[model samples]
Target: MINTILVTDDNVLDNAIIRNYLYKERYNIVSALNGREALELLESRNIDLILLDMVMPVMDGYEFMKVFSKTPFYKEIPIIVTSSLDGVENIEKILEYDVFDYIIKPLDHINRLILVNKIKTAVKHRNLISDLNKATKIIDTLSTTKNI
Candidate 1:
């Protein structure tokens, strides 16, 4: 199945590059200019992962994560932070939001490969969690029916 990825970055060029790379991998790309727009997209899109940029005009990554984490349904979606901020403090701050991975940009070929690998890993983990949830629900229903 093609997973939908939400790329949230203020830089149009960054978004274009990421979309171009992921397109080759057959993943559906959804671009957002800022965290607010990303939140709006999340309301309608079935996003499997988020590629977030820390600095943006409106509602930066930190603010986005604060709002997003409060959302129970969305909290499970894996987020990979892509930012130019390489400071350890910056990374630690973002990590507090529980992102799946943090990647520093400009995405060179090696960084792109890392991004793709991380995406693949996150998608697999999400799928496994989904399958487990389904199994647990089925078991619960069977147990309920047996009791009845």
Candidate 2:
């Protein structure tokens, strides 16, 4: 279960819209105006996934990804890019970070549902990978113990 979600966007209205759609689902929602604030929140909170916007003041999404990817906690949380920018260069830059998925802005009803589905899938995928890593660690430990 994805218990906590971070919504990072410079647009206040856009953040509100996302909150409205997700409120019924009852997940703990955390908001940040930009990547710098998001990073501050992540330092103290447990975030299952992030709904990130590409354009923002202070720190953009690409800068966030670069910093996030270097952290030890990167693998535990998944990020879904929800941005208004459609430029080819923007997409290519975001792709380099290997985000869970990229979602364009102006989400209609169908697109909203699609976004929710994608979030669910990404959360499940992150959890599965985490579990696999734990199992691999256990196996490695056992192998080392047997050798000793």
Top-lDDT structure, candidate number: 1
lDDT of 1 by residue, 50-122 (tens): 9999999979999999999999999679999999999989989999999999999999999999998998899
lDDT of each: 0.93, 0.88
Those runs of model 2 whose alpha carbons end farther than 4 Å from true positions after fitting are: none
User: How many residue pairs clash per model?
Assistant: 0, 0
Compute the lDDT of residue 100 as modeled in candidate 1. 95
Instruction: Assess the local accuracy of residue 69 in candidate 2 as a C-alpha lDDT between 0 and 100.
Output: 93
- Candidate 2 Cα lDDT to native: 0.88
> Model 1: what TM-score?
0.96
Give the range where candidate 2 is weakest over 10 consecutive residues by summed lDDT.
19-28
Question: For each candidate, what TM-score against the reference?
Answer: 0.96, 0.88
Evaluated against the true structure, the overall lDDT of model 1 is 0.93
